[model samples]
Target: MRPKLLAAVLCLTLFGCASKQVVPTHNESRVQAEASLKAAESAGASRVPEAAQHMEFARQQIADAERLLVEGEQEAADMRFRQAEADADLALALARSIPLEREAQRATQQAEAARRSLQ
Candidate 1:
């Protein structure tokens, strides 16, 4: 039991001390982020000031990720790419809500009219 415990501890320690090794496959993430940003833009995110911040943040994050990638920081680049993607997604979602808001307003007006007719 003592030998087994020692072996397990040694294995854990060795694994813990090992340097993190991640493949530099950030190209896919970069592409995904860029596509998302473009989608948000094409979806009229810029037209809605509410999503402007998200679109800007996403752009900045993509730039930073590119810089980090050039600096050979794969992990940081990947994180930034993911962040950019999320921001872009938020911007797109906000842009999409515009039509939904209009629909809801129209529905409310119809409901008000129906109630007035009943009265």
Candidate 2:
């Protein structure tokens, strides 16, 4: 009984010390950030001031992430990549909103004109 117990404890200790692979998030986040940036550009964020600012921020964050990756700071690199993706997404939204805003203003004017005619 004593021998079996000792063997069990030794096996448990060895298994606990076994190294496991650490999957890095840097690559995944980097891919997401790039995609977001492309979407923002396609939405014409470069032509919209507000969106352009966010898009620029996204680019900078991505650059930072890459630098961090080179430095072997996987966790920090992952964070920067997430930040970049967020900024790019915001830029895309803002770019899309510009055209929608114009349409809204046009509708408002048409409504006012119809109201005046009715009066």
Q: Considering every candidate listed, which one attains the maximal lDDT? A: 2
Find the candidate with the highest TM-score and give its number.
2
Write model 1 residue lDDT over 17-81, tens digit each, in one string: 78667554789888889999999999999998877789999999999999998999999999999
RMSD of each: 5.3, 4.8
Using Cα atoms with residue i matched to residue i, what is each candidate's TM-score against the true structure? 0.70, 0.74
For candidate 2, write residues 42-70 as lDDT tens digits: 98999999999999999999999899989
Candidate 2 overall lDDT versus native: 0.93
Residue 103 C-alpha lDDT in model 1: 93
Poorest 10 consecutive residues of model 1 by lDDT? 16-25
The CA lDDT of each predicted structure is 0.92, 0.93
Candidate 2 — which pairs collide? none
lDDT at residue 104 of model 1 (Cα atoms): 100
